[model samples]
Target: MVYRHLNEKDRFYIEQRLSEGDSLRSIARALGFSPSTISREIKRHTPIDFKGLYCHRLTSRCAQEKRANAKQGQAFRQISEEAKMLIHQRLSTHTSDQATLFRTNKLQ
Candidate 1:
């Protein structure tokens, strides 16, 4: 099975079904998702002040903010232009590929 993130439409559907007094299991079945998935989504996005109410618009915005924040610390940040120029200069002057590779790996 492939994993997929739910979109705004799915959130709207959930909100609609919830407002209609549908059971979580029924909503899950209708949406072709597990009941626990639906349950968790509601729990994750529902504000404490909302008193169990689920708002799709607010939930979507909250999810977007979380995703944006998560992208701050990526595994490999881009090298600056000056650093790239220095690397190019060093590599161009190096005679042995193996020695250059070893030095680069050591520096990292």
Candidate 2:
């Protein structure tokens, strides 16, 4: 599937499934995502004071607020630690580079 972020409807579904006592794996299956994705979504949006609680509306609002507050490059062109090291030890990273350095190390 093409990569896309979760939306309010998805969050609402997640909230509903969670309220109905569904497992994260099951929820992920129904939503076409990995169990870890569902788990991380829950953990990411859970209210700290409530520990395990997730509210879709609040999550939506928070997400909007975050987007509105986001700064440029906060989500793009993030050089990896290995990439950073390559720059200091080797040279700046860029497109059309030789295969000698900056091979795909891995992703987080």
How many residue pairs of model 1 clash at the backbone?
A: 0
Best by TM-score: 1
Runs in model 1 lying further than 4 Å from the true structure: 74-104
Model 2 is weakest, by summed lDDT over 10 consecutive residues, at 99-108
lDDT of 1 by residue, 1-108 (tens): 878877899999999999999999999998888999999999988899999999999999888888888888674466555545556777889747676555556555
TM-score (all chains, Cα) for each model = 0.67, 0.61
Error of 2 at 104 (Å): 29
Candidate 1 positional error at 49, Å: 1.3
Clashing residue pairs in candidate 2 (N, C-alpha, C atoms within 3 angstroms): none
Q: Which stretches of candidate 2 lie over 4 Å from their true place?
A: 73-108
lDDT against the true structure, per candidate, is 0.83, 0.76
For residue 87, model 1's alpha carbon misses the true position, in angstroms, by 13
Residue 12 lDDT, candidate 2, scale 0-100: 96
